[model samples]
Target: MSIQRRHTAQQLGDCFKVAAELALPVLGRQSRHLDGLTDIKLVHGIVSGQGKLSGLRFTHAWVEGLDDNGVKYVVDASNGREVALPSDLYYLIGEISPSECVRFTPEQARRHLLDAGHYGPWCGAPFEHEDPVPGVAA
Candidate 1:
């Protein structure tokens, strides 16, 4: 069965924190056995779609994991709900271009979080030309 989109009325802007929390545990091997997933990663990229982020190509974060059957999925808990979508569907809905995304392994995420001191857009994020939104750390 296909996973349906799950979200609440809450406005979503904390993609980084949510994604990091979900990714770190699995990537660090702290919760790997819980779901039988592998090759987990934290993905950061520019996205544009409906809701709060509509009409803007802003930096966003999410986690990706490969299931036992080798199918990839995107797990997002940013909008006050946790939803897991097939990778292709997630990318299509978000209008995410793979070439513009940066994927981080557990080790890289930890190192970057330590060195940068934040969840991040990290270096080489695609939002260089976009003006920063007030109260948003992108």
Candidate 2:
């Protein structure tokens, strides 16, 4: 058999670079809420970014943990807790192997956020997002 390169889901920054190269404006990454697959993602452009998120500036971030279904989850750095964020609360980073989903329901997992104890804080915070991207947001 011939060797083939695996096509892992691209990272948020990698996606950005791809977007920049291909000129495709919009793209979403797994948010820091689902777990680590691609359920929620980071949607950003090649310009300014969001400074305010849910009364927070998004000063910190971290990958929550993989849900039962394989979905990705992210968390806030400060509290070390998984947030009950909306499904559409996308982030600026892109996903790798995004198709994988969390096995459990969003509500159920959220209830166990504090108990699961898989929370963490990111050192490199999200920067300013670029202008609106294409094929991403309406």
Candidate 3:
């Protein structure tokens, strides 16, 4: 009998770490405004998979902000991706309180990644696992 091994998507800190670092300068200067609310400080959140990927959750980090016109935008520094914040995994971490900020170190970041079950080398594939459809393979 032969054993088959499947590959998973690649996990790198370039997107997450770099995005946070790059956005910090802008975040310090800008504030996001929501509909009926006053301007509020921007935040760094992890967007777990944005485009069309299978059921796999790949963590792509981005910063959320509002333009002067009150339009919301998500900025990705790794690729300079500016788009409207999707209604998906926008988890905010490193914030102790609404007014307090906690910058995550390399160790802390690794810990969170491990806790999320996303620490390790991946194959850069889209789907985390095969589709459930009958005999459908990715």
Candidate 4:
């Protein structure tokens, strides 16, 4: 089954909540406690555009694992701010490899969300930018 359900920010937030809850116990318990997120695979990396402007890239954090049917899917909790890209929407890019997902504390995760340039409500950053790509001065 091809899962096409788009998760609302609220729903996605809950996913992060679960990650945070699971995260609390792992802190200091084990160094890589946040990696698996119980059943979810949390990943932080860049997913890039595959079209002519394929040079365009985005830095993001996402969760991936099998659904009830065992179909793997990528869950982007960024709330569409910086292209909450589905796995199919873009290909992975840079040294920020998704295959090597790193676990972060709740606080670290929050900072990463903001640092990755999220423009949504959870980001708490004062500014919002439509373009995910960093601007270069001419």
lDDT of 3 by residue, 1-138 (tens): 111223232333344434434344432322232223222222323233434433323434444545566654444445434334422322332111222222343344344434444321112322233212123221
Question: What is candidate 4's lDDT per residue for 1-138, written digit by digit as tens?
Answer: 121223233333333433333333442322232233334544544434344425544333455544455544454433322223334443343234445345454556546444654322133321112222134221
Task: Order the candidate numbers by TM-score, best to worst.
Answer: 1, 3, 4, 2
Checking candidate 3 for backbone clashes, the offending pairs are 8-123, 9-124, 10-124
Once fitted onto the true fold, the runs of candidate 2 whose alpha carbons sit more than 4 angstroms away are: 1-59, 77-88, 92-138
TM-score of each: 0.75, 0.23, 0.35, 0.33
Residues 1-138, candidate 2, lDDT per residue (tens digit)? 121222222212233232221111122333333333444332221112233222222212222334666644443322222244323343433221223222223343233222433111111223332222333432
Off by over 4 Å in 1: 1-12, 26-34, 127-138
The candidate that achieves the highest TM-score relative to the unseen native structure: 1
Question: Deviation in angstroms for 10 in model 1?
Answer: 12
Per-residue lDDT, model 1, residue 80, is: 73
Which ten residues in a row are the worst by lDDT in model 4? 124-133
| Residue-pair clashes, model 3 | 3
* Clashes in predicted model 1: 0
Per residue, candidate 1 scores C-alpha lDDT tens digits across 11-59 of: 3367776677787874232333227778989888867757654665667
Estimate the lDDT of model 2: 0.28
Worst 10 residues of 1 by lDDT: 1-10
Q: Report the C-alpha displacement of residue 40, candidate 1, in angstroms.
A: 0.6
The number of the candidate with the highest lDDT is 1
TM-score-best of 1 and 3: 1
Score each candidate by Cα lDDT.
0.70, 0.28, 0.34, 0.38
